[model samples]
Target chain A: MTIHTKTLKQLSQGLQTGEYSSQELTQAYLNRIQQHSTLNSFITVTETQAIAAAKQADALLAAGNAPLLTGIPMAHKDIFCTQGIKTSCGSKMLDNFIAPYNATVVDKFNTAGMISLGKLNMDEFAMGSSNETSFYGSALNPWADSTVPGGSSGGSAAAVAARLIPAATGTDTGGSIRQPAAFCGITGLKPTYGRVSRYGMIAYASSLDQGGPMAQTAEDAALMLQAMAGFDAKDSTSAQQDVPDYSANLNDSLKGLKIGLPKEFFDEGLNSEMATTIETAINEYKKMGAEIVEVSMPHLKLAIPAYYVIAPAECSANLQRMDGVRFGHRCTDPEDLNDLYIRSRGEGFGTEVKRRILVGTYALSAGYYDAYYIKAQKIRRLISEDFAKALETVDVIMGPVTPTPAFGIGEKTADPIEMYLADIYTIAINLAGLPAMSVPAGFIDNKPVGLQIIGNYFAEAKLLNVAHQYQQVTNWHQQTPKGFE
Target chain B: MSLTTDDVNKIAYLARLGINTEDTESYTADLSNMLNLVAQMSSVDTDNVAPMAHPLDTIQRLRPDQVTESNQRDNFQAIAPQVEEGLYLVPKVLD
Candidate 1:
């Protein structure tokens, strides 16, 4: 197979053995990205910058002092600021905004000499579940042209799944990374909230936003997460805990692993076929000497209502920086200061963004604060408590990543509530600040189903261990989309 | 829980986002739908539960009162839409 089809680890090995130079590998992926332009996976293609970075990697490799990611080419979701690159966060508001500095994640990857292809597209400010909310056109699922690659990390999922790049960086707030990873038949990890720094990653919901890895396999994700996970002094919320070597425990046996299946995740709204696919994957775990326990997260149904209130409220606060001022889009010839602020924001933000800001503003408004904002926060506590209780008895929780496989583009746009329900299975994990992953399980009507594996806080190594073991026995993750190959 | 157009108008004004006259109806409908969806929170009793402002509930880490960054006003102001003499230009706030 060509270099573009190789796993990230395989590419690293290839570079080490002199099979291809970093420049050659970078060129190969850039060519594939050009070939698959119709997928709209990238918001910016840094060909000139990528070539220079790859040359630098080649120099390090020549000296036999290259780091693990020395020559690997990857894409970052548009949310992470790359110094001097347009970090739009998939919104028109920052369309002209060239990042003045690098996000902590970008700095880490650059320090390891990783070559970035460019910024990948995403939901506007990472708000939508379906990427349909992106100001840049929605990224298409490589599995089916008409279907959406899930968002707010849609482009990251699409590019990685289509093999335009071996892997990409993605941020998950409410199932953005995992859902798209499921729809696109790839592996995605949403690390525990504070595990990754949020310094220059454009904020969506401050408490829920987290950056992680999306790749073709659990091993690749583990490798990427190794570099991405660490505390930065710049991010006030960064955890002070020591970073663990994610790849160190990937080969651990799954025998005696206690997996919890939340009843609410498999209840009424789940598609029957999708549930069956998840069941088969669970049975595979059972055959591997793992024990499955049924657990109840009774307040999981409250997650959506709570998340809708809390996320928007935080989003409204977080996105207030985009008003026409020092930076970002400015409306033409404003009559006054108020006119400038209102018109610039109104014109800059998309429909879903506006709707969210409005909802958030209303929720946090004086008279409604106790009724809506505080109530949602109380419900958030209950949801987190439920996960905390369930996780005490089981090593990990297993569920469907999304309620169904990929839905067609434009299907749920008119009804925002229907679209919000797509994230039902995944949102509670975010609310609880737990680490979770989505791995390819099987297919439904030719679309891939994702088996979501959620672990307790700081349990990324265990999650990767479980997923790596499952991937060793099943070929689901290795399956590539037809035309993309 | 249904929000009227007037309510939406007030909310938009509070948010400082201008809604075009033509799009007001749709914006009102969309905002109302979202509010209705979130209205379920009020039905659940949360009398004694403490409001969670953050996930980990970690307090902000305070650093020593020392300067960590050097002045880069020129570099920072370079990206501003309108700037003059290292100062960001904005609409007149007072006479």
Candidate 2:
């Protein structure tokens, strides 16, 4: 009766049939969180509050009325503001900050009757590719204790991998969710821009930030997303569209499905181990009656450059709220009005955050605006056009989620370029505003690797079908991390 | 100096960041290195390019302007560094 081994589908059915009360399920997760606390996957565990919510969920079930995610224990990335819970965004600035209102995603989860297992740790302000940027400290991969989980969604991915939570929420600005999901060997998806509301989710880059689901399997990821996606007036950018049944057509056959493998993803920098794993997954799809086409996304090389400029530029503007006079951390010394601003942020944000802020500010500066920020935007359009053209000829794109499997803690923290390179394959989807996913493919060095599946904008159902169909044929997603009984 | 030490100080202040003037020299050095890294964008020609503000080509979704937020100012400002009558207080600037 280990909580980590069971799927959300099974958990939900059990709850619906009165097999286990929400309180029992919440207690089991609380017990597991205590047991695996050494992983540091969670920054805050909502035991008392979660238990209360679970009691309410159970009551609803008993009353013969329950939501789609009724009584299921789930995890949230710390970036989302939870009413009355600590929402640190992995920075010292908000270390003492408790959100007064639930973020849109959190409110949606509550409405769906999902129990909050805990808040997963992440990079400060969702800035870095590695979780090392977190002010609380790094969240290591569950698969290999020494390796780093790709982040700022690292803690969420690690939580699901370690069996602490069945599924968790993750935000992707660049590759925050998918990269971490790949590194930790789980299922993570970043829906098309505007698909998910961002009002409650802390913004890193307004244009790029998207909140989605991360879980052990694609089906679980859909279940998690079902609770999180929708339109809200609070977030003007949220799409005004009906939420689709992501689990619909999930079990559909993959026969004759057109899969495009962008040539750029298989280039020189790809690790041989990851390359082998991805190729094997592609072949598995072929065996399952799918066609693999070699498509070219020539502007692929420009993604990292465009992302660096665009993400940071947007970040520099979005982060202006953390002034000393306002929210979060404020410096103690008050020599003058200026010192309050400098030392407060200097003391508040992490190194990666400061670096990006500095980089972003410079990019948006008057003289450099046209050269750096403006040009990056143009390149972004071309990248999007490339995807649009490719989609016309294909149903989906397959590639390595990351260039390598998750590396060990402190492995690439010092070398920012190396860490940035890890996001090579996944960043393009975000730049294109397309829905993409990372599904556990195979092992590399006994560590998990993910095969990235990308679909056209608003094509999440197709992407989920691709992952679900592969799961029916392969057992990779079923491979649980060690120390799980 | 692509930007002088004083220029760095001015920009930091303008951005609402407190830059320790004593560290201005070092800040200039760090910014110089970063700018050098970002300088790669200058070489690419972008004369005809339309700057992208969003990844999507869809028209900006607009909602009727009205009161959508509830009276959660107390809930929100409760986390502010200094809150008085629903306003975030700061050091006196009119002196």
Candidate 3:
């Protein structure tokens, strides 16, 4: 087997044993990245810096007492600010803006001795579900060239799935990380909100945005989260709770574990074949001594509407910083300050972003604030309460990440509302600020589907344990695309 | 509720985002469709439920009243579109 196909843990062992040098591994991955450029997974390759960093990691390894992740290569989603590197967040607004500092997540990974391959492509301002909104075009799915790789973290998932890099970082706000990870057939964990510091990570929705790890297995995800999860004083909303050792309980038994299957997720909207695949995966859990219980979350259907209002409202406020004054894209020869702000933003933002901003503006306008914004907040409480009540009876919840597998590139882009419904099953977890994961279950017509595992607040360790146990008995997560493999 | 072109224009102005005359009709239709989707929230009765601005419902953390950031105006202003003498230059705001 090629070194690229090995899991992160195995690669770590290889590096520790001197079977392969960090420089060699980094070069191999870089070559793979260049070979697979058709996937359009990366916005910048950072070749020279990556090589230099790998050499430094090699020196640390030679000197002894190096971290387990010392020589492993990975990449970051462009949303995370890396000093001296372009942090576009897949928008024309920030296309020319170079971040002056590193996001806390990037610094943590660098401190762990991991070599960063480069920045991956993503949706414009992390807004779209298909990644077509990116200023840099769509990132095609590795499974089928014609299909999308899911979004805002589309490039992260595609790169990891193709083995261009063993893993990469991703952020989830209304299923950006998990949904793409699902469509690409990988394991992605969205840590409980505030579990990871959001200090320099670009904001889409303040209350719901959380960064986590995407990898080929839950074990690798646990390893990545070990380095990524923690509180930072820089991020006011960061959790003060101590981050537990994520890798410690990865092997814990799932025997007698209560897994709740929300009945609302199985409605007619779900494709029947995909539902069968999910059921089969659940039956495997039943075999492992996990007791399945059907739970009702009646308010779950309202998550899409609630999220549309709340996320856009928060986005409208957060994105006001993009005025041409400080940095980012600016229009030439503006008539006045108002023209600069309007023309610059109008030129910088894409259609989806404009649509969202307009909706948010209307919703927060006078006479409509109480009707839309406040009403969504109240519905948000109900959604959170539903999850809280469900967790009272079950240890975790399981459902399909997307209605079906990856769809064609232009399939749902025509109707924005139709595209929004793609996240119906995954958005509520974010609303509740709970930890969840998308583990590859199986395939439908050569396309991949993910089985989502949801856990209560700060229950990431439990979620990882559940997903790891299933991955042990199934090879779905290990399956790679035909050409990529 | 369907939004008229005037509503779209008003919203664009409120957002400080320019919408081309040609794209106005499409933006109006798209924004109206999104609002129709958002209108579904009215079906849920949330009279007694409290509004949840934050998921964890934790109060904002307060820090000591001290300057934690050092002066890095040069590094920050290096990426500005137009700057002069440590100041960001913009179009004339005064007549």
Off by over 4 Å in 1: none
lDDT of 1 by residue, A356-447 (tens): 99999998999988888889889999999998898999999999999889999999988888999889999989999999999999999999
Q: What DockQ does each candidate score versus the true complex, computed on alpha carbons?
A: 0.82, 0.52, 0.91
Give per-residue CA lDDT, model 3, range B1-95, as digits (tens). 79999999999999999889999999999988888888899898899999998999999999999999999999999999999999999999888
Best-performing candidate as measured by lDDT: 3
Candidates arranged by lDDT, highest first: 3, 1, 2
lDDT of each: 0.92, 0.85, 0.95
Candidate 3 Cα misplacement greater than 4 A, ranges: none
Candidates arranged by TM-score, highest first: 3, 1, 2
Candidate 2 accuracy as TM-score: 0.95
Report the C-alpha displacement of residue A78, candidate 2, in angstroms. 0.7
Name the 10 consecutive residues with the lowest summed lDDT in model 2 chain A: A413-422
Stretches > 4 Å off in candidate 2: B1-11, B18-37, B42-44, B85-87
TM-score of each: 0.99, 0.95, 0.99
Residue A188 CA error for candidate 1 (Å)? 0.2
lDDT of 2 by residue, B28-69 (tens): 766665565555555556677777777666677776878766
Which scores greater on lDDT, model 1 or model 2? 1
The candidate with the higher DockQ, 1 or 2, is: 1
Interface RMSD of each: 1.1, 2.3, 0.7
